[model samples]
Target: MIIKPMIRSNMCINAHPIGCAKETENQINYVIAQKAKRGTKTLAEGGKAPRTVLVLGCSTGYGLASRITAAFEYGADTIGVSFEKQPTQVKGGTPGWYNNMAFDKAAEKAGLKTKTFNADAYSDECRAEVIKQLKDWGAKADLVIYSLASPVRTDPDTKVMYRSVIKPINQVYSGASLDMMTGKITQASTQPAEGDEIPNTVKVMGGEDWERWIKQLSEADVLADGCRTLAYSYIGPSLSHPIYRDGTIGEAKKDLEKRAHNIDAALKAKGGAAYVSVNKGLITRSSSVIPIITQYLGVLFKIMKKQGTHEGCIEQMERLFAERLYTADGKVPVDSENRIRMDDWEMDPKVQDEVNKVMPAVTEENVNELVDLDGIRHDFLIINGFDVDGVDYNKEVTDMSKIEY
Candidate 1:
């Protein structure tokens, strides 16, 4: 098999209107096909459909999945808030804005209302704008999903700069492989986490922002009664613990998990709830860049794929909505650690045991049998609609300045 070039661009950058639109259409079509395949009931009956939804960071990854869930499964009128940049036609354009446009087009076709706010969710001005828009629509959101991942955030009170980072927990001497051509992983080495990086990483990736979003929303009275909110997280196998769970990012996730309790208490007064779902590991743009984990992910994907239990962001989000979030009991289940155990299934003992046996011997020659590096990279490309079947990649994409929201 031939390896394609990997595209390394800015995260949370400008979006291409047409490409995003095509992506939105594609997701809607995929969801419709999936629903038909599963024969699940739509959320229309008994007035269970989400009437109003707010998705922060709705341009990519889990945020986009939540938006798709609202529109496709529950038939909700949605508002997506993101700091999406408008791409210049000269450079390779941004994808999120076009994705927004595409999603809007699908919503129109489905007879559901949709809007997008292209602004920083951390800014007071942007928050006010979203609140005003909600008031204008007279729609308090029944579900709010916070999925923002940024490097810097200002304290609402002190106005201090807080920069996020990813480091190991202990002194790590791990081996990692990279694809110099596409920046894709072909191999890697394993090691232990360093000590100092944990707190700093936790400070960055933890649940402070998530809690802040919920507090502001509740204060604004935009969260409807019985409202449910969720944030995405990940916990992989022991092989990845040093670089993942037991590492700096893991410490931050621990902070996030702790914040869930505070949020749950805050929302309980209003009959609302908050949850942090520890999702299965996949080749997200974010995950693919982490140390050592990339090769592990490639290997894990190969194992899970052979087992026929692999899932991407869409699959994870779809499951989170239908099975976890919108379930009949209205309670978000979690493990003893106060973390949802979504990844546990993916890293089952039997599965991990088998993968662990093969992990030590995995190299470029045997990687294909031990891991799904191709699949991982393929999903990464698909996030931007590259390698998507039936789509004309060379088509001249039109510029879309703004999405109405």
Candidate 2:
């Protein structure tokens, strides 16, 4: 059947298999092109790069981008962990499932070693399987990228599941939310967190799972000497602080940042380090439904594109590896808080000033002129395998399980 995007409440609920495969291939191609342009080399060429890498939540968004950059750009053998449903005879699976298929197929054709597991990353069993795989290969992980984003996480110790919420703390949040499909603006409000909601959000989205993964890997001796680890975070403009940076999710991120220090110390004892990378905002599956993020991004994208400094997931990850993680002098440059700031360009004073100026004047009548409504809509659809280039959407997809990647 000819597939189209099924969008509701600014979220796309369905994905096209062929479109997903093509999009993954696009990211892989971008990384390969960058590798050649930047003159990056493998460890055999006497250049600095990770030999063995592990990526948790390695199937979608930034996680998948990180995996692609590591394997295609740096020639690292990668072990990926993500939970995604498989396609059935009647229906296609999640976008991440198709993306993983494309990635694995591309990696095999390129002769890059990879092992992808479809299991919960928040579980101890998943960690054990990764460790066992590393031991079997007689390889140790030198780079571990933690980029998992889930609304729910079950405690590995108690088996109790916790869900995360995006509510603000101590104050009500009211902002204009953009409907990417209809371009209709509506007033969206969320009450402050109450009744153990903050703690529960922390339990689901915080750093405990990240620390657990590191400790288990270190204990199993699956970590290489000078091993480096990173967890992705975001801190947008202060205009979004009330709903994002200072919200319940923000509290959870604080825990994530604080635990980075503990993990850093533990890894530092063995010539390793841990860091939290604050990444740029993009139209992701999770961010699309946020109170003000969609509207904010529409304005931000307009100014950034005009300035010629716009970046997507693939662009950000490539720059992170080429500039920040691996430098010529072996010194990783970071902010005063020891965190890599990939959002530097997005938060530039000039860019933010334009965004701040344009946002307040935006209305339904002039939204297209004031904001990148077309750009935002395209990005929203692209995340779920729609609006991608070089994909024949009119063609029938007979099999949901296969794609020519």
Query: TM-scores across all candidates?
Result: 0.87, 0.99
Q: What is the C-alpha lDDT profile of model 2 across 88-169, one tens digit per residue?
A: 7568899999899999999998988899999999999999999999999999999999999999999999999999999999
Off by over 4 Å in 1: 1-20, 37-44, 178-200, 329-331, 394-405
Which stretches in model 2 have alpha-carbon errors above 4 Å? none
Give the distance in Å from residue 218's predicted Cα in candidate 2 to where it truly belongs.
Answer: 0.2
How would you encode candidate 1's per-residue C-alpha lDDT over 1-405 as one tens digit per residue?
111223553122233344455556666766676666655455565534467888988988778877997788777889998875565534444567667767777788889888898887777777788888888888888888888877766766677666655555555636566442244444444444344445545555788878877888788988899887888787787766776677667878888988999998998887888788888877666665665666677777777878888877777777777676666665667778666667866869888887788778766666666666677666766666565565555655443353222
TM-score of 2: 0.99
Query: Candidate 2 — what's its lDDT?
Result: 0.92
lDDT of 1: 0.70
Model 1, C-alpha of 312: deviation from truth (Å): 1.1
